[model samples]
Target: MSTTPSDASRPSLIRWPERLGYGVGDTACCLFWAIVSSYLNLFYTDVFGLAPAALAWLLLITRIWDAAFDPVVGMIADRTSTRWGKFRPWILWSIVPFMVAEIALFTTPHLGPTGKLVYAYITYSVVMLIYSAINVPYGALLGVITDDSAERTTLASYRFIGAFVGNFIVQGILLYLVQALGRGNNRLGYTLAVTILACGSGLLLFYVFLSTNERIQPPQAENSVRRDLRDLLGNRPWLVLFAMGAISLVYLTLRQVASVYYVTYYMGDRGLIPAFLLAGTAFSILGAMLAPWMARRVGCKKRTFILLTLWAAACNAATALAGPRDLVLIFGTQMLGSMPLAAIFPLMGSMFADTADYGELKFGRRATGLIFAGSTFSQKTGGAIGAAIVNLVLSSVGYVANAKQSASVLGGLRHLMGTLPAAGGLLVAGLALFYEIDTKREREIGAAIAARVRSVAAGRPSDS
Candidate 1:
């Protein structure tokens, strides 16, 4: 927790390789994330033979546990003082556990329904716990890597490009690999697939640790846990981000997970899954590349986000208008819908960094770990709630696993994939109106924080 005066002066200090390294770390992380968010429920219900309602409970309970546990991890990370830095050390230490938990999560054991459910709970919980350990610190790393708001946005764009590439691999290549490698055994395919993904993710994380540096170090005197929590709670921008994280993730999760069902059941072609996902991921990559430019043009991140969100909503609605037999229309809408969303992740990450700046500017202390950990809580909670809601809706509509879906169930799948998520996107757009951190204001805040840091470093009283 020590930063030099040099670190304070240069806002856009990160080099291209460093930025590339940072983005690669997220690409690695998103491998597991893309698989779980896009396919875990389907894996449980279809491949693992768990009931939809039971699976719902498992997702809900585990995510609630994640929300509660994230802050403790955050607090520990903030207090951590390592040669490598506070946040990077966690990434170093937690990779093994994260790898182990991931493999266990996708491995199906030979057990009765009861035993299977127990196994799901055990494996998923461990994976999530380890996930929080690594990812919370990873998110916090963004703030410390560079205090430059514009550079952070650029870095976020790179990060989501990595994310889309990871998703493309998982979404486009994974199922086919599973089918090919498993031959006929889905369980085997999942186990082998996840093993490869987990191993690759570990290597990428190692690279992140080696290639990146944390520049925004904390003061030697740490804030008390209570004080940190108070500052976090009082941070208006962070609060907006927290709520936005959950709400938007719910929309994202439902739309992503439901697409599997939509293609498989409604379209009656399991082979199309890879193609559909690849199309969306490709378009998403384009969107990620375009985000910064779009935001600059629109005059602020919030406004650009709103425009993109509304565009996404329209794309989703268009998907709903296409019938089950309309393969071309479905694919077209999926690609179009996903394009704008590609911008959202990078924009959100950049904005979360802004909230950290806001917290420091307003509260006189920086708790990057705590603030980002709360964001992790919001994400897991939203994902869990969204998954649970999808499962419940599927169950209510008489969705029988591995059987031909009824018309009613097909309708439900379409709504889950399209209409509901579209509405959620609109809600996210509306909520963005309340968040007041524009690019101009962000620079103003960043400069002030830099001045405060310099004052404190020189043994003078900081006016903050």
Candidate 2:
């Protein structure tokens, strides 16, 4: 394990108000994101009139853009100096564009098929770019809000609760809202519903800007981008987490996209889509709520993360046995699977913060924004890979839009929804074991970084 000078002082405890303030941003983000990630594939195929092959390419292309884009945003944010702080300023600046891009994503324009595809490409690309601008900073802000590992866990839980709330609302009410708003026109309903959600998302982000503060300050000396990139490359913990987050996202994206198809076709009850989404996410909240306590009991975040993820994998794999007629059993298994998944994001996020501290301790500089940016990139990349796989699998199985699926199609859907996610879960669990940062090591990094900050502020050289 690495070592640095010990500091007696620890970061102050975060208040509930500030914690809630930080959480609301994710709620707003998810309002846009949950809809796009969970429902976009459906919208593209069913309403937007895109072929599965086209949608697959679209997902891959956009995520490739994110691969380059997210890291640049992170690097810029790190080099940024502002009265509002490095991360918080972007949150304030990007809100309008973010909202506009979201609205554009759900808007249905009457155009030729090629025109519509072009519009989809432009709008979706803009939305993701804007998302990186806003959300990359938002995630990096978690590191500055507080340095306490335990407190970060608590904050992550609250953040995910807010995320779950957004998911619940979207899954439970969005379609109904669209139905009510559109009356007979699906296009109009989607537009109006997303418009309302976009406005709400913006307001919540404003609250985050107003309510949170950046407490942990980065180093005063400006480092070259090359140096920062070099540091990032050497960050072992961050690399482990980056890989883990990517794999985790693969499962999450696949399962969420597949659930819509599974309900619409196999279950033959599109009405139950919202209910199914609601139950799974709601149970996930319970899992997230329990994460801090579980971490404490296990004596490390890695253990808690690994155990919960594997449990979710088991639950997801069990769904393979449930046929179309096993409605109650299917839903029950989904709820059970979601419980462990609920904690996964929060736990992993807290762990990432640890990795950030580790990077600082080892590299003699801090790059919170860059680290989380890498994480965000991994997630988007994972989503891209997963989405492509699902769409291609659907096409290969002869899944026709708005028609009864053949047995091959049903089998493909089952594997996509069940086996794939379970495999991802196991992969996450396995990769986590390679992560070196634990609670004790995290606390040590914090202390060392704190001492280094003090030394720099006092015009003394840093020991690292």
Q: What is the C-alpha RMSD of each candidate to the true structure, in Å?
A: 1.5, 2.3
Worst 10 residues of 2 by lDDT: 1-10
Q: Against the hidden reference, what TM-scores do the models get?
A: 0.97, 0.96
Q: Write the per-residue lDDT of candidate 1 for residues 1-464, one digit (tens) a residue.
A: 12578876556678999999899888889899999988998999999999998988989998889878899899999998889989999999999999989999999999999999999999999899998988889888888998777788899999999989999989877887788889999999999989999999999999999999988876554569989988888998888878888998898889888888989999999878889899999999999999888888887898888899899999888877888889888999888888899998899998998898888778767788988899889988898899999999899999998999999999999899888989998898888889989878877887777787789878999886
Candidate 2 root-mean-square deviation in Å = 2.3
Give the whole-model CA lDDT for all candidates, comma-separated.
Answer: 0.88, 0.86
True lDDT of residue 387, candidate 2: 90
Shift of residue 160 alpha carbon in model 2, Å: 0.9
The collision pairs in model 2 are none
Q: Which structure among the candidates has the greatest lDDT?
A: 1
Tens digits of per-residue lDDT, candidate 2, 333-389, equal 899999888888999888888888887788767888998899899989998888988
